[model samples]
Target: MGVTDEVLTEEHKIEIRRYFYNHQNADGGWGLHIEGHSVMFCTVLTYVSLRLLGESSADGDGAMRNARSWIIDRGGATFIPSWGKFWLSVLGVYEWDGNNPLLPELWLLPYILPIHPGHWNSARDQCAKEDLYFPHTRVHEILSSSLHNVVEPLLKKWPLSKLRDRALTMVMDHIHHEDTSTHYLCLGPLNKVLNMICCWVENPNSKAVKCHLARIKDYLWVAEDGMKMKGYNGTQLWDTAFSVQAIVASNLPNEYGRS
Candidate 1:
């Protein structure tokens, strides 16, 4: 869990944006976890976060599109890192062909199973018990921004009834920070896809943002392969492993370093 604030004032957002611009690695990079190699999640997400804070992606502020290209070239959200793949797969952006076949079989296991997050988080109360009562971990509050009231419900980002009117609104605002600017429409689903739709719909500008959505929707066909992606990149490891495995499985072997 990284820093989770109820709200980041515009001034604070600007200051943080300045920090990312000034403190980014001298190599014109930022690594995963502030220590590891640069990754799609760190590069794209952080760079976008900076931009949302009002940093420019152009040459004058910093070439954030360079980072976006890193993610795009490697493949966008689909090819980010291991966790990225898992989530992308879960979110239906990637196929499970290369995954290690997570033993959700464990869900069927007897109570004695040892490797569960349930077992690992010894310091915390039983997740099952806690969830039974509380059911979710999201921290939300009353919001005053236009994002919470206007954008959230329009996009249908979360279970609206479950959320306070304020919380649902907040979700749209956060997603809007990136979606409104990035021209990204990766996570396709009835509701999430609506966010992209709304961005274009709501853009009162030159109608340019609407075109971005039009382009993304160009590859929206479904199939028996079960909505397989054209070439979405979920996690860095997920994409790399998938490519490597396909090559090896084809019996045309080659040496590639596996992270």
Candidate 2:
């Protein structure tokens, strides 16, 4: 894991490409999950991912072209959800100003505060219609509007701006603590990736980034379809328990052990 060479081999690339192609929806787009309906969020993300993997827009038997068409027909990548916008911004495809500020300063507030950013709330209700399962309430809209229009500007002022820097330092401290405690695996794949991004942003050549890079393979798994990112680092204990229960319930393990 300490090796400095590229981790993903050509074979790994081929398998990952196969995994994307294997799970492509009939409409030539992708979904948030393997079995989900094609939505702008996942479709755009998948299309960009394949492009990053060196697939031409005309590749995939025109699957990439169809994906572009699907996105255009649904008002382009602008219709993608907030998470999509964030990643696209990170990838340099979308402008950072387009995204609602996910203030790290929120983390400095008391945990008991009801207005914490961790609450299940959308800062902007502009997701694609397909991904908009829950519409924003009037109260939510008002609060978000106030935050964006009033509170955000005030926070940028001289006195409060000082707090922003302090808040960011505290946020990075928490991220470092989480990474060290989890041995660089973090809580889940999403957080793991986010923490790695944070670590790289803080210092690209730092040991924290190296450790995170070393653990990238922990989330990858291969199946009949191809290589895919697993939902968690590992579930070996859970899988073992489930398998043993199933075998015991069938009485096959007991009967077959003698053979």
Candidate 3:
């Protein structure tokens, strides 16, 4: 869903084109959401999305041209955030080294350690990961603080080593478990795309890729403007809670003498 790897069908392409065109700002760029201001993250993703949907950069309207200029003014796609870089890498539009390490082995950390993921609040863990991805010597500082990072360079140099292979096997198994447990839905669209890519890389002929592809439609939504990817399949529980609150506030039960 987040810069999906799946090839879009002609109908899917049409709907996505409508969605992008409808959402583009007067400045010929996009924001993180419909009402949000234009930012590099959103702009880059939307620009790539349009290209993926078959919009050429040479279009007469100059939408892509304007976006390219805007992105260049902001230091181009290289300035995109970690998640953006990750998606671009999967799309083969960007190099993976631009992203700080997101070693799946981090999930293998012992729970008893103070730095264990189980000990982290979501926000803290997120910040920690972002800090890990920072581009400067700060990345070195962050990596030096983690034992896993300390060994990552050594592992990379010995790609054919038994230890590295075993570690990768473990990571792949963890990924598969995550996919199976989530019913191939993943934590959200971003993770779903990453998981699908990971599975494909590990074994293109594997069932994992088939399952992820099969469920791709779950993340899409058809709106009045056109089709767009939802953050999740549905927020049924959230909507239900709001509906109940609205019903309670209307005093309909009192009017019916139910109270």
Whichever of 1 and 3 has more lDDT, that candidate is 3
| Model 1 CA lDDT for position 17 | 60
lDDT for 78 (candidate 3): 96
RMSD of each: 25.5, 11.0, 11.7
Off by over 4 Å in 3: 1-7, 103-111, 118-224, 229-259
Model 3, residue 148: what's the lDDT?
48
lDDT of 1: 0.55
Candidate with the greatest lDDT versus the true structure: 2
Each model's TM-score, in the order given? Answer: 0.33, 0.52, 0.48
lDDT string for model 2 (159-179, tens) is 999988898899999999999
lDDT of 2: 0.87
Candidate ordering by TM-score (highest first): 2, 3, 1
* Model 2 Cα shift for residue 241 (angstroms): 13
lDDT of 3 by residue, 1-259 (tens): 4444355667888887788777878776688889778888899998887887778997527778988888998888999888899999999989877889867776799877776556543343344555666544767656654644456657666654668889889988888898999899987889899989999998899999999989888898889989978898767778878876777799665654643
**Which residue pairs in candidate 2 have backbone atoms (N, alpha carbon, C) closer than 3 angstroms, thus clashing?**
none
Pairs that collide in candidate 3 are: none
| lDDT of model 3, residue 159 | 58
